[model samples]
Target: MSTVEPAAPDATTPAPAPAAAPSAVEVRETQREASRRDEIAPWLVALEALRRKGEPEWLAAQRDDATARFARLGFPTTRDEAWRQTSVAALARTRFDNATRGALDDALESMPAFRFGGAFAGREAVFVNGRFMPELSSLGKLARVRVRPLRQVLADDPDALCGLIGAAADDDKHPFLALNLAAFQDGAVVEVPERYTVHGPIHLLFISTGGAASHPRVLIGLNRNSQATVVESYVSPRGAHSFCNAATEVLLGDGAVLDHVRLQAESEKAYHVATTATRVSRSATYRSHALTLGAALSRHDLGVRLEGEGADVELHGLFVSDDAQLHDTHSKLDHVAPHGTSREVYKGVLGGRARGVKNGLIVVRPGAQKTDAQQQSRNLLLSREALVHATPQLLIHADDVKCKHGATTGQIEDAPLFYLRSRGLDEEAARALLVWAFAADVVSKLKVAPVRESVERFLRERLPAAGAVPGTRA
Candidate 1:
């Protein structure tokens, strides 16, 4: 679990040239369709559809706000200032067939990662392609907590929840977020009462079987002095080129705590765009760990806001990619109140022609004095073709704050590889060991044993032969 600096690449290798610009016809077609699709998926569309079916006013207003923000800030491309390093032009070519509204019982039963029966023994909510599967979901009292589908929650009491759901997501220029805002269907809602603590983790499984896109939203509320842990998983077993746009929001009350983890392992031909937003209150604690593998193109945006004094937050994440996979992460830690602390660490292992990007931003306002924040990103390249962009930024208007940011891009150390080989281990085994050890710093932080083990297995299977699991000697 060492946070060692990744070794620099040898000077002998040269970087590859950038891909050719996309065709004008292709770009124009996609942009036009994007505008149309954005409108179709906005809250106005959802609200109108719901109203025609006799829905409520508060929900409609929530939709109005979301749609207005969406319209204000439209889809973003790599050309945009924030997305300059992570080109999403490939998304324009993606055929993300929306997941049809149907019974996914068979898909759920046959899923590779759907192991909720044992590990997720308590109430579990299952969604295939973004729509809730009542039969697949086990909703009930779990470890002193009540769990139910979001649609049910809204039906019962929309006024109490609309603000929480809609307020968590603001208008991001990211197309994926815009699409999610427009197209999301049902989701899960977990409520923990005051002074309660859920002994086990709440598991939410999102599987994209095939056909249609999946936009799933999740909400969790922890009352004062309450504590809980949530694990979200996304997987696609059958289809190639599937698309998953998912979002989650966790609201922590005073003195509450939440440990959240998201594991994304989609098919090689798939595309994944996910966003997680957490708002922490006074003296609350929030920690998040993300493990991403697979997917031809994937991007995750983590936005955290410390809104009250004495809030503590940590974001630990890692992604291992190969075979032309593209992965990106953009995180913003906002210190809105004084005496809050935040830390961010992200690492990636890239091979083949895979590319990765990490953008970590820390914003401390003028009156947010006594704030402490640290951000760091590191990446390991497994091949000469691999590329990574690491940018760590800090905007601190507070004169009395302690903040620092750092980033690095490098590969496995040749000396370590040679030394391991001299000990009689083969080259492939030696490299794999080093790569695993390099990624272990983030993996070790996963509190859920099963989830952590699953991530390790994914890395072993996805990383190339040259990647070796470091020996116990290290």
Candidate 2:
């Protein structure tokens, strides 16, 4: 037939042969992919602005890597193995603007509650909405230790961060960590030279204001035989609905000792997520005191690697949740060398309809003989509506390792309550005394005086009844 060749279909015209319809699973997956994209788009937008800055090539490359990793990892869902018991859907659903300079309210800054005295006033790196504020901060006459802002290092000597910036944090598998690496504006960079001892504890104070998202980063390096203490604290105005994604990486050189304290007391309307990674060298010691409260939802991941012989790690964790708040803590202790020792204890106090979760894993690798690891999770539920979930695990590949894990979750024991009541205490005071006892084990681990006082103040403010206990102030 001499039929003229059909004109090619126009751009908008459909082809004569129709494509096969997508399967149900394929359709569902496409929707999920789109949702994930939506969740990450805001952060990408924020990163774009940061990329325009004249940052070092190496830092740019690191950010690019983190961006790719973030896209691949996406946001963790309850369907994921590690997130099965915790859902970040709310955090993922909200689209947040990147926090900017001048985000802190002047009136808020002048509030008596925000003022600090003693050690915190001595050496502090202050950040409001992820931007460093030198006006309100002081480096405390540092000698051999370099306690400067991350922005300073990124600009003055990015070479210093070549191997240290992203060393301990695993952004490849953790989306939040990747997000932080991609979007962090400024943070504290602490460097303690070998055989030196920092005069005082370095305080990293990060404040979150409502109406946006913040990314706070900290990189700490303690050289051989060096010693230092660091306190990473987060707080916000009451009723603020903000988002804070923080990451802290620490490297302890051989024979180094470091004490880390992390306190999170955000608004009940806020969401907080953080990751802390530490690598300990031969005979190095790492002590941690982690306390969490006040966020509507919060999750903290702590990972420690004993890279050389005789490395030791001791961790104390406490979480107090009320009014439907949810706190999730996940810790992993990896013993890679011989003669490693690790001890972990986490306690929880829940009231109202609150919930608490403690997930811990201790792994002893092959040839890591003489490894000793202990993990415990103790929880106290204050009401019938409160709930807690604790999962402690031990994975050992070496033959001569001593590893043990246990968890206890229950309401306040009647026996202890009765005893406290018999000691001329009212029901409320009695209950508070017992609760304090339950939490004292972990709270007492904070060695820094200012930190201890601050945490105690928070506990009292959160639970007025707890303030009436014997060992508390008005």
Candidate 3:
């Protein structure tokens, strides 16, 4: 049996001095050894088990490569450039067992009202603890489109999923991506054929029951000239402290169009990290809306690559953090071909002692002329104790590109509160209205009516109560 290594000590703690002076060479070697000893081994054991279960040789090789990468990178710290603002040491210290094989009995009847009765009423796929439960799903037949559990696809024809799974995501830089590649058991797979258009959006629901770790992977592909919309929802029972690591990859063929909506509302005690990678081909379009509202420590990474001429991409995100929660979002858009266009707008609201971070980047590669890109990040602090950090960047290699970026972080304006109060609104109602208006910029971009309304309702229920902030008195 292989033994797992323990988590490293907190970075904030000072290291003890050596009894005897040591050479610099010896100290470097000792640091390397310590790093190796901190690698998580149980996750490797689970990966090996999956490989030994008769998975394809290619997949086994991929898992092995990812395992090595993850071992080298280990868990990130606040010292790391990408993680300089957020600390994940607490998550690393927690030892989480792999999820067990079981479905929640109340999964069907307990589906959240926000998820059901929508335009996507009977077209939802449900997964509990990273395992697909067909009994709770209602995915009917659609022309020129195929939706199936990823495990089923792997079991039937593993080769069919090749070149699409890890094509857009880079595990070398992100250890979480490596972890997902090494241990993800099952998720959703969607394929739309050439020139086909799905009338309704496809909904994927993932729920966790706490006390374990779940890795969920979603793969979506749209052939040339096809169009589809996908909705992904992540939630958990209140007070659950589970750990969730998820990755999603989307491929758009020439002239294809795809709209994606992601909703994350996990337990207040849960740890959640997710990455979304999208690649757009010639004349293709890809748009995404991300909403985050729950989790003790949550991070979402969005990466988009415009690899073909005339491709377009847009990203919109909103996050609300309360209590002592922490939420972070990092996004990157790469324009590699001529005539490529990209835009991003993210808004965040922080209350109580909560904190939020937003980092957005736009890159136009060399020889990519006629590239148009813009990024904006806006934040609101509902309380004096709340904090936020916003960063927006633009990297243009071509002189003929049009690129712009901006960021703003502050509290609600007293003018808006006074105006609302003058309109016969209570103090609490007025405050809530202003907060919603700040978030409406992102929520209004949602094309799905039910999704937009549900998100609005959720924000209304979670926003800080009236007069929660000390200086809000007009």
* Best candidate, TM-score: 2
**TM of each candidate vs. truth:** 0.86, 0.92, 0.90
lDDT measured at residue 140 in model 3 versus the true structure, 0 to 100 = 72
The sequence of per-residue lDDT tens digits that candidate 2 reaches over residues 325-419 is 99999999988899999999999999999988899988888888999999999999888999898988777778998999999999878898898
- Against the true structure, candidate 2 reaches a TM-score of 0.92
| Candidate with the greatest lDDT versus the true structure | 2
Angstrom error at residue 428, model 1: 1.0
What lDDT tens digits, residue by residue, belong to model 1 across residues 82-194? 77777665564445554355426546555645663367765577788887777766656485687777777767876667567756665445556655655567788888999
Per model, state how many residue pairs clash.
15, 0, 0
Whole-model lDDT for model 3 versus the true structure?
0.83
The regions of model 2 sitting more than 4 angstroms off are: 1-22, 106-115, 464-467, 471-474
Rank all candidate structures by their lDDT, best first, as comma-separated numbers. 2, 3, 1
What global local distance difference test value does model 1 have?
A: 0.77
lDDT of 3 by residue, 314-427 (tens): 998999999999999999898888999888889899999998989887878887799999899989998999989897777777789999899999888989899988988878
RMSD of each: 8.2, 9.4, 6.5
